[model samples]
Target: MRDANREWVFAQRPDGEPDMDSFELRESDVPEPEYGQLLVRVRYLSVDPYMRGRMRDAESYAEPWSVGDVMAGAVVGEVVESRSDDYDAGDVVTGNGTWGDYSVLDADSVAPVDPSIADLPAYLGVLGMPGRTAYFGLLEVGEPKPGDTVVVSGAAGAVGSVVGQIAKLNGCRVVGFAGTDEKVEWLTDDLGFDAAVNYKQVDDYGAALDDAAPGGVDVYFDNVGGPITDAVFPRLNVDARVAVCGQIAHYNDEGVPTGPRKLPQLIASRAKVKGLLVGDYVTRFEEASEQLGEWVATGELGHRETVVEGLDNAPDAFLGLFSGDNIGKQVVRVSDPADD
Candidate 1:
């Protein structure tokens, strides 16, 4: 049994942009669990744009972090020992572990993770929350009809990449927007997105969108909302559906950005734009997971992972996401051969 624990805490809220100083790496005595809790050794940690919103001292769909509190995130782990009958030692598990090498969680917080179909990290990426977010956001909200033309912003990232693939699986013609040409290449050449635009090089995203989807945009899966998103709003077809999954551009922004106005365009096109969160769709996860698992095992839904080699690199890995440093799901390899 370990006598100590190491975890990252929120050091301070950022004024405009988050810096490395916002995080504090700390160590303390290992926390003993209550009767129903289990101690898990983290294997992989997830870094997502939503975590940026939680850092601010403001009202949000989730709570803001108190200074010195453990930052909120998710991890895939192994139950080293269990105090509850619902779990036992050596059970591979997945849950919200945040930025820590180990965590004590209640029985309800952990889920059984199958490594035979997917390695432990896949539970954090392809078959986990990001996967669920993509599946529901695209299928339910975007409603991509077989011949629909879909455009996904932040297309090279975890959720965006997955959304593009799922849209393709549904027989939609998918185009993606990424920050870098390398990411653009990865999306088109590797992930099967029909077209990929490097937003950094494109002065007019709307023009690029038009060039890519000459027929008109039937579905817009927006991961980044800002000038780029504003450009897309007017391009939607009459019955176009927009799934607002994230706004990474706003996440790190110093202030809320004013736009070129959308209601007018919304009225003109009768397009629909709705914000989406994966937690709201629970009944469908099991069904989606079954299908996703099948595709993953069958090599139909291929995935690429950008694994940062160590736990300490977690923050760097997270920050890199906004810069398009990762082409697929960004995960930290906290430990390999986790159960020694």
Candidate 2:
């Protein structure tokens, strides 16, 4: 075991887009496990759009990260030492852990991870929070029906990718909007989307959406919530359901940017727009995990991951999300669980 631990600490809050100055990579002494706690070496960590929101000094569902504090997120790690019966050495686990080389967490806070089930990094992506978010938000909020025209924004992203697949599994015609031609092709040619729109190349978003979704959108799973969402409003069918999962397009905005008023369209269509958080479905995590695992095991659900090596590169991986640099979930590999 190493005597020194490295971590990313919240340094300065960003006014617009986050950069290297936003966080400081510092080294400290490794902490030991106390009573009912276990020491784990972080193998992989997730960098998500939601983390951007937490950086701001604002009131939201998640508490804001104070400057000078250690950055935190979902992590998969291997326990090297334990002080509780619930966890033992050599056990792999997943939980809300810090962005660091090592973390001492309460045994109850982490659930055991089985490497035989899936790839280790998958726990930070498909089999973790993003997967659960897509599962509950799309099925429960969007309530897609058979033959429904389901439109998804950020279609190539972690959560959006899963949403599109689940909708397809339910027999819905799926349409997706992404920023690049490559992502659009992956959504349509690979993921079985009925149609894919390249938002960056389009002149008129509403026209593009209309062309892709000729039958009209019955269920819309929105991840990027700027022009794409505005355009979707006019194309929504009556009694449409919109799952407002994430507003990645606006996460970096210094202030709320004005957009087209589309509430009237919602009223006219009698549509329902609901925001969701994965934590809200904690009670049903097992149910969703079980089904998603089955789909992955049977090859019904497919996924991709963009991995950034090294703990020091975590910030780079996180900033890449806004640029659409990742085709799917962005994960930082801190170390190999089998290594020290």
Candidate 3:
């Protein structure tokens, strides 16, 4: 174990969009585990869009981070010291952890990682929270059915990618909206999305949707909200189900985002729009995990990850999310696993 630890701390709140000035890397003594806790050496740190919401000083499902507080997110790590009977030294686990080389986590809070299932970082992506989000959010909230036209925004992203694939498995016609042509091809060619629109290249999203989803959208899994979502609203089929996941398009906005009132369209379509928070389905996480793991193991489900090296670059990885820098899950590799 190292004698010192390096961790990122929230330096100052951003006025609009955040940059390096928003974080500070600090060195401190390595934390020791207390009873019912374990000291883990973080291997991979997850950088997600939802973390951007936590940076703001506002009331939300997740508690906001205060100035000078240690940055926290999901991490896959190996236990170096244990004070609980459930886990032993060298056991790999994942849970809420600080953005640092080492973090002390409650044993009860983390789940053991099976490297045999997939790569360690996969625990932070496809086999972890993001996968679970796509599974429960799409199935329970979206309620896609056979022959339904399912549209996913940010379709190349961690959650959105899985949403499209799962919709395909449910016998639905999947159409996706992505930023790059490469991502669009990956969705349509590799992931089996029936159609994919490169929002960056398309001058008119409504026209793109007209060509891609000619039958109208029956289920809309929205990860990026804004113009793309605006186009989708008018194309909703009757009794459409819309799962509002992440609204990355406005995460960094300083003021209220002004857009076309979508309620009228919602009324016309009689759509059921619901916001999704993965934590709300915590009790059923094991069920989702098992099903997702089975799909991943059998090669029925596919996933990708964008990895940044070192803890120092964690802030950069996170900031990149707003700019749409990742094709799939974005993570920072702090260190390699012991067995690796």
Best by lDDT: 3
Arrange candidates by TM-score, descending. Answer: 3, 2, 1
Residue 105 in model 3: shift from native, Å? 0.6
**Over the stretch 147-236, how does candidate 2's per-residue lDDT look in tens digits?**
999999999999999999999999999999888998988888888998988888998988887788888889999999998898898988
lDDT of 1 by residue, 62-152 (tens): 7888998987688888888799999888898888876887888787877889989988777887798989999999999999899999999
**Residue by residue across 137-167, what tens digits does model 3's lDDT show?**
9999999899999999999999999999999
Q: Residue 74 of candidate 3: its Cα lDDT? A: 96
lDDT of each: 0.85, 0.91, 0.93
- Please tell me which predicted candidate would have the highest TM-score against the true structure: 3
Residue 337 accuracy (lDDT) in model 3? 52
Query: After aligning candidate 1 to the native by TM-score, how far in Å is the CA of 76 from where it should be?
Result: 0.6
Superposed Cα deviation of residue 306, candidate 2 (Å)? 0.3
Off by over 4 Å in 3: 338-340
TM-score of each: 0.96, 0.97, 0.98
